[model samples]
Target: MNDNNARRVVSVIVVNEASVLSRITDLFSGRGYNITSLTVAPIPESKYSRLTIVTSGSVRVIEQITKQLHKLIPVLRVYEHEDMVEKEMALIKFPISENLSDINTICEAYNGKIVNVGENVVIAMVSDEPKRIDNFLCAVKRYNPKEIVRSGAVALER
Candidate 1:
């Protein structure tokens, strides 16, 4: 990353169609732009889907990408988010023998909790700001996590 490179969150609203996602992703890949995180979800009671994309680029690079996104046929709107509420979720599995109380406390601090307990594993889910989630992942390393699954970033302009 360069000094000019900064993380950006872009939200694209598009008509729901089978090929829309493929085309959008193709646009990024074809242009050599990297998408660090992408979250797509259908808008409730609407014929559209919202795609939240997280990427790092210089200001001019992000502007170029946004301009190209608007040219796609199915795209309804595209904008870079500012003053947004963004979040990410992570699920970490630890051995059953790990300290459940400690894990639960950590999860609670991150707006999550142990959601599942199996005979041999315990799954803790934490949803929080992306940076905080990164911190949580680091904080839990001492417990010897068996597996970890993290979701892409999602955001909404506040």
Candidate 2:
């Protein structure tokens, strides 16, 4: 595989501390790794945080990243998601005048629903597989979405 096109999602469990995020990001930047998506949040009732990072590189480069991450003082565990169930959440806002019924139908198709409705705007939220979310975005283009926000990928080993 080409070095630039290989996509991998890596999950890192690290101590929840102020400088941990900066240290981890510095590691990537120093090594010239490009992170496509990054999400960090503390695990409930625990002193650790989960960092979900999406990046691309060749197999060798990924292995190097894994090894380096393991060497970090705050990092506890790292997992490269393989055969896991991953999901992403997205929210889209569009003009309310543009057929609310049609928007609801499209949202339903993606296992989403209208999350908010105002006089001028309608907001829909969806949590689905990455590919499905991508398709949903493509399908809703005709609505002229005012804004779209997608959350980082979250995974559970199945």
Best by TM-score: 1
lDDT by residue for model 1 over 1-158, one digit each (tens)? 33467999999999999999999999999999999999999999999999999988988899899999999999999979879999999999999899999999999999999999999999999999999999999999999999999898999899
Q: Model 1 segments beyond 4 Å from truth?
A: 1-3
Give the per-residue lDDT digits (tens) of candidate 2, residues 1-158.
45666878899999999899998899999999989888899999999999999888888888899999999999999998777888889999999888778889988988899999998999999889888999999999999999999998888667
Look at candidate 2 and give me any clashing residue pairs. none
* Residue 145 lDDT (model 1): 96
